[model samples]
Target: MHLWYAYMTPRTIVPVIFGLLLTVVAVEHIFTMTILHGKSMPFSTMLLSTSGNGSDLHCPSVRLSARVLPQIALASYPGSGNTWVRHLLQQMTGIATGSVYTDEDLRLHGFPGESLSNGSVVAVKTHQLYDETFYDRTILIIRNPYETFLSLFKYIKANHTGAPIIDKYITEWGSFTANEIGHYGQFYTSWMKHLDVLPIFYDALKQNLTQELHRIKVFLGQSGIKGNVRCALANADGNHLRKHSAMPLDFFYSKEKRLAINLLINQTRKMFKDRFRNVSESMGTWML
Candidate 1:
């Protein structure tokens, strides 16, 4: 009977083969999800980073102490020293830091949203803080209010044309909520006060970088990090800085235009301070 079945059952043999394929696939998935827990088996052969940057996989079974998808936002108004801080952190931490990743990346990859990846820590940088519900920890890097306004005015006037009238752009696009037209400062101020957060002064970041770095390390927990702070600081590579630099100051800054922008910025700051007088007290931290 067994010999006859083997010789006569083509349909049964097809189902058997398909069943085996499905079983193999299921086993692989189980290994990846259940047994591995998003990490590959340690001490087994592993794939190297494609860029020849060495494998993030060092010790088998262990991952970087940083959260799988941690975000490092260098929050600042234009010219408030966001880029400088980014450079310093990249150098000091031996990690790639920048503001380029889009909202899609944050939502899709193991970045601002997903569970942290094994051996990877995702740092995101941006001046525009749109969503308050995101980020495990948010760090706000602030500067003196008057200087912040001056730098912003210089940047916008330099980059955009039709100077004094530029408040239209800020009035229209800068608010956290669409209906809050002519209220760009509200968005900026709201961004200044949201999430599980820390506040870093830009002056401190520039003048006393060591102290700032120490604060950052403490925030991130320096127990598992390697290398000396000087080595990390010396590692600043300019590859990630904004290329095709535009000196906005050369392009626009009619005195009239500067005044208008300054007015709007001041008004925004006032509105922000007025509306959220006790944000820190209310939220237990400063979450907008």
Candidate 2:
């Protein structure tokens, strides 16, 4: 190889070097986008990043707690049963969970006071969609899509200012069911696609408390939990949240509005039907 190079003309070597440089540039462009997309990096970082500098992409990184802390993510779609699970877990294991959003009480509940510098087993509850770098163990809370949208609609109406019932419902379902989270069904699939996530259906939590509790505990690596699952669930049930619920006969105010919202959901499901085909088929059989 040395003798060949030594005997080569400058013209031949120059062209070869130029070709190799172009190949490197092309490879770098594709490689940067592929890995960054896989990591689900932030859009802002992607916008700001240059293909030439792969480091510019933001990758999700789990911060190690200095001590024996095993961080678990309790992530769910908003209006899912994430909070209910939190209450149950706290009651069962007596370990308080933390939220990314400000909930000072949670931070105080057995979490490392020094900003997670110590290894304390703290489950962080989040409404964000799946991103694998967050944690190996995740307890995903899933709710019936219709029920989820209804809860979100009511919550938004009561809390933040928004459009009319049907309009708001349609808008939300069409896009942005979760901010920074993917589409509704995509969010579920993303978590389920990975082996590490344990999905806890909301109905099961309500109807099959014992079984769901067992699954939740097992996923969080807590085995042999005593009979407090039922007790914990019952204790958490309350009148306050129920009081704010939309009236029994006037949730959407009319059948027409319900149809409009349903139509929007159908359109969305049709466009992405391959992944959400079952959800769409179920919606078809749904009663008004």
Best by TM-score: 2
* Candidate 2 lDDT over residue span 2-110, tens digit each: 6877988998999889999999997687668745543222333332232333444222211222345465777787766565566566545544455666644334432
- The lDDT leader among the candidates is 2
Please provide, for model 1 over 31-55, each residue's C-alpha lDDT reduced to its tens digit, 9 standing for 90 to 100.
6663333323333543222223433
Taking all chains together, each candidate's TM-score versus the true structure is 0.43, 0.51
Report lDDT per candidate: 0.46, 0.52
Number of backbone clashes in candidate 1: 9
lDDT of 1: 0.46
Looking at model 2, the pairs that clash are: 67-119, 69-119, 69-120
Q: Which ten residues in a row have the lowest lDDT in candidate 1?
A: 279-288
